[model samples]
Target: MKKLLLVLAGLLLVGCQSGVELRHGYWVDLRHPAQGARPRIKVIVIHYTAEDFPTSLATLTDQQVSAHYLIPRQPPQRDGKGVIWQLVPEQDLAWHAGSSFWRGATRINDTSIGIELVNNGYRSTLTGREWQAFSPQQIASLSALVKEVAQRYGIRPENIVGHSDIAPQRKQDPGPRFPWQYLAQQGVGAWPDASRVQHFLAGQTPRARVPVEKIMDLLQRYGYPVTPEMTPGQQQTVIAAFQMHFRPADYRGLPDAETAAIAAALLEKYGAAE
Candidate 1:
């Protein structure tokens, strides 16, 4: 009887061991299966490292700064397996999107996944432009990553944003050359509807038709952190962030016909969707 009991206990242990996987350890509990909360990933915040590959890696890994993934500005490898590096696991939090706000969420690091791209940000001079453009390989990998993450976490299109979009006053990484339109075309993020933009623009003079208060209300309604009583400087910073995402052709931080049109279009589409 004792020998039989020992054999049965060993078999039960083997069955439990075979049924579960734990990192560098062994444990088993048959309480429940497929039981856990869904991934808490609510937003995907894109950024540029503003440095070379090696430097970016070191800063993101060694320094306090970190992200869920890092895509270097390099061609895809033969196997296409190493286009991106997952520095931090998806289940963990990364110290990116510092002191940022979006759509009533503040300090968004708590619910956002950050992806850092390799490139130098914009330079001061125009003739001697120093900002490097993101490569095709990088964008392709980014699209795949964004789609995969969004599907897994049920992240909405409008939730895919840049660091600049969250922290407009301080950061502008993944700048105008980040190929946002391409990502939108690939169904990675939200793009302004052309008809809505045209409707906002057609037969409209930009002198002073829409009151500033109305514009501010619409901007806030569209997820920007704009307040009516904001200082002029603060208002410009927020507007510039909007332009960087929507109307990259001009991010001068001043409201114009194009800016108004784009802003209204975004509000009409995503405001309703959200």
Candidate 2:
């Protein structure tokens, strides 16, 4: 009876302390929270593992490369969730994106979550490069995972991007066939406004003609690695990257009417938001 009374007294004492909780015999104050200048996280960069599942696991686990999570192509049924294999802790910096930049942020691995998807990357063909299609099931799983991570980190939809979006010069994983539009429909990534695109696509633009400088400005506004000083070859790579994300039906890297329309729409929608 005396021990019971002492326990009640201790509970009463804790209940009286302002904004304090006695947890595991330790008093924790809830008033003060740790403050930081930049958000601990700001983006989620998705990738496609160039090799198969086993090779991907081996590579990501290797000291030379790493990622926060890995999703295999032939994922086991997960009752409707994405097949996620955690390779690194969320708090630790993963060496997945090498020499990456986006939205003025360099060395992106420091402030982003990397998700590596099991894929063949790309196939070299007689004509040029051929991209492999992702499984519907895998995409569904990825959609769910993307939503959860984005919500947890308060990451904007536009900030969820492919690795190639950050490093177009030497990287193109999560290629054009990756169905970014589907993810965008599910509210995971950014997609240009269809009405606005249709307006430009129908050749009913407000301007008499859109110039190369306008297209470049739109691409830059949408966060592509493009600049006025870039060489023609360098600019083409960035344009190809942009097309792969927004206008996958035609990604020849040339400034076509369709590409310009898509770029303008994206600029009006996402760039304005940013």
Candidate 3:
């Protein structure tokens, strides 16, 4: 009897230490301490796995790239039910954001928690035929997860961004159809004020040659990785990414009146902090 009691106690202790009581899933190791050993999480990077639900699960589990949660698209039910899989603990670093930067900080994989939603991405189609949107059920689950994690980590609304927002040139996941404005309405991330942009643009002189350097500076300030050595093609890519996020109505990759106006307004609104 004494030996059985001791064995049970040991098992309980092990379970507690492993945090296995929290959820059900295969937890894989992808640990890397942040530089300078910061204890706080500064960003929440959102992504869409450009694969089906099952394939994403296998890749995330087998490959080195991992995220804190995998919000899969379950089949729609009459009662509208869905589930979110917690693939990793929030406290550990997930190998998702690679060579990324935001708000002057680099190596975002260290300071950010990544959450991947299973969607086929824009390579599918603009009609969203190839990709799947989050069901009402899935959104509820995802919203709850975002709220829980953001509150726990003291993450700001602006810090919660799509993977493409941080690494625009190399990525386009969680594409334009991701309903970012809807998320912002829920206090998740920043949404540009279209009226403010229009007002700012109205004030600009006609055919004005706004400083390209200043526009680049504003993008870099907002964490877009605009460097001095960037070639014209690289510049266009970065600009296109910015347009995708801010001026989705037009993304011609040209620094036209509208793009310049938006960039100017953004600088006016948020550039002072930098």
Candidate 4:
């Protein structure tokens, strides 16, 4: 009876503390956490669901694709704030980033948390396709969530990226209208300094031809998955991806002074430190 009482007391104490619990019909004292360990979550990948809340929820829960959290376009109010859904736990892996690479890390799903926002993505109109804009409420909720997760994992500002950033060729979710600059203002992601960009921009005109190889080198240094084997078209796709993130005004995939300058500024701010 004493032995059983001691085990029960230990279990009760452990339940009150932050530690791993085992359930093999007995409780083991494991409260001493290892100092050499760190969280596997190093990156936070933002995405757009490309569907309504119901459809996105259904697809994420039923299908193979999943994310750590989902913010609805019109989230239900709770406690005077919007409510977001958590589809997957942070400790587990979510298959959101498929065939992706960033900062020399491939299979990004292994070490990242994915956040999905409900959006229609884009609609085809008479003139052209119109991309959807994220709601202010959605962005607010996302900012809060991202701040919390980044704090928990000590994720860097540059590590907070969109789905298109890690997989440029095949994906473009959380697209041009995602307001990356706004997020950068909130200290969530990377943004090139305007002054530095202008400093580089001052050296050349809009039509000045910057070599494609030099631009590619700058992008690779800034953390895109550019490689030597990529053809001209593929290289353009990569450049377009970079522009989509930094220079959303035009993403023609062609090298220009502004593009090169922005790349250089980003490298100067983020890459040089690393």
Question: Highest lDDT among the candidates is held by which one?
Answer: 4
In the predicted model 1, the residue pairs found to clash are none
- Candidate lDDT values, in order: 0.82, 0.82, 0.72, 0.89
Mind sharing the TM-score for model 3? 0.74
Candidate 4 segments exceeding 4 Å error: 1-36, 272-274
TM-score of every candidate: 0.83, 0.85, 0.74, 0.88
Q: After best superposition, candidate 2 residue 67: deviation in angstroms?
A: 0.9
Q: Poorest 10 consecutive residues of model 1 by lDDT?
A: 20-29
Top model number, TM-score: 4
Residues 173-205, candidate 4: write the lDDT tens digits. 888898899988997888999999999899688
lDDT of 1: 0.82
Per-residue lDDT of candidate 1, residues 48-132 (tens digit): 9988899999999976899999998874576765468999998888999999888888888889999999888877776755567
- Counting clashing residue pairs in each candidate, in order, gives 0, 0, 0, 0
* Model 3 per-residue lDDT tens digits across residues 4-103: 9999688667766765342355443334445786456888888888788889999888767899888876533445545677787777878999978687
Candidate 4 lDDT score at position 228: 95
